[model samples]
Target: MVITDVNEYRLELARKMGVTRAVNVAKENLNDVMAELGMTEGFDVGLEMSGAPPAFRTMLDTMNHGGRIAMLGIPPSDMSIDWTKVIFKGLFIKGIYGREMFENLVQDGGADSVWPRSLADHYPSFLYR
Candidate 1:
């Protein structure tokens, strides 16, 4: 898997963890780096760990069609995303908050969280629910 970060230390950690490709966004061009790494169609799944607005946007821009994204970090107070692309490309974005919220709930309770149940009951089209 490819890990993208601005910190050298984190890149090194990712590399040590078996990620052969890591992008230091502060120093290299992301598209060029991905291209050099032979990724033409972009990633199939993206784990948005940084929660930086730019990182989130980049993930949205670079994911393949029908891409799924799980976010772990806290979002910026003033974040903005392109909803048009999300709808057209059939992107699925799920927010994973800290212990008190969804991700932990889903993980610990196996889709028993109120959010998933609500979605499943109300919006049958959303299969993720």
Candidate 2:
């Protein structure tokens, strides 16, 4: 699932990228949607890209046992979270800042040069054209 504020364009993009669901977090009940999707206590991996404290909290709350959360969002300076819940749940909170070596290559060069030739050969035409 891809959570966005209220951008239909982003939702459509997520759908095009094969997301099972694209939820507008601002307009809907995220908790209910998560429950409906059977993501409660079953999701092993969560990528927090919304940068909102509420979104981070929601992701942290729903993580399953031994789950990992990759936080790529940039929260406000005074951001707060439930440390007790995180500690009690034994969740692995990983933070990623900036791109890795491979992603750096993609930034410096085009995907055709950074990715394997075989995979690059199948690059989405729309991305280039």
Candidate 3:
């Protein structure tokens, strides 16, 4: 997996975490770094952990056709993104909220329960332990 950050030291940390490539956006272009990995076609899945709008856009710009993205970050200020890419690439974007997860877990009566069918199906052990 490729990990991108604004910190060089953070990139080193990513390298230690079994990431195939770590990009320091402070020093390199993400697309250029991705190209160096022989993946000009882009990534299939992107997890937007940072709430920065640019990070979200970066994920969108670096995804391949039929790529999917899940975002945990909600930026303070709205930023414009290239809608053309979303339409042309057929990318799927989703927002994640921890409250919803907790609600589903509680309503479902533990991880073993099946009330929230989608959650249990996608992640059986998310709230199991």
User: Which candidate gets the maximum TM-score versus the true structure?
Assistant: 1
TM per candidate comes to: 0.71, 0.66, 0.69
lDDT of 1 by residue, 77-121 (tens): 888899887887799887874565545547756344223343243
Regions of model 1 farther than 4 Å from truth: 97-129
* Candidate 3 lDDT tens digits, 9-102: 6566556545677887877898787778787598987878788888888888889999988776677765688999899999988888668655
The C-alpha local distance difference test score for the whole of candidate 3 amounts to 0.75
| Each prediction's whole-model lDDT (CA) | 0.75, 0.69, 0.75
Tens-digit lDDT string for candidate 2 (1-129): 434456777676555555667888777876677778876454677778778898888877777777878887789989999998788878888788455634744875634432334333347867654
Ranking by lDDT: 1, 3, 2
Clash pairs for candidate 1: none
| Model 3 TM-score, all chains together | 0.69
Error of 1 at 73 (Å): 0.9
Q: Which stretches of candidate 3 lie above 4 Å from their native place?
A: 97-129
Selected candidate, larger TM-score, 1 vs 3: 1
Alpha-carbon RMSD of each model: 11.5, 7.6, 9.0
Q: How far is candidate 3 from the true structure (C-alpha RMSD, Å)?
A: 9.0
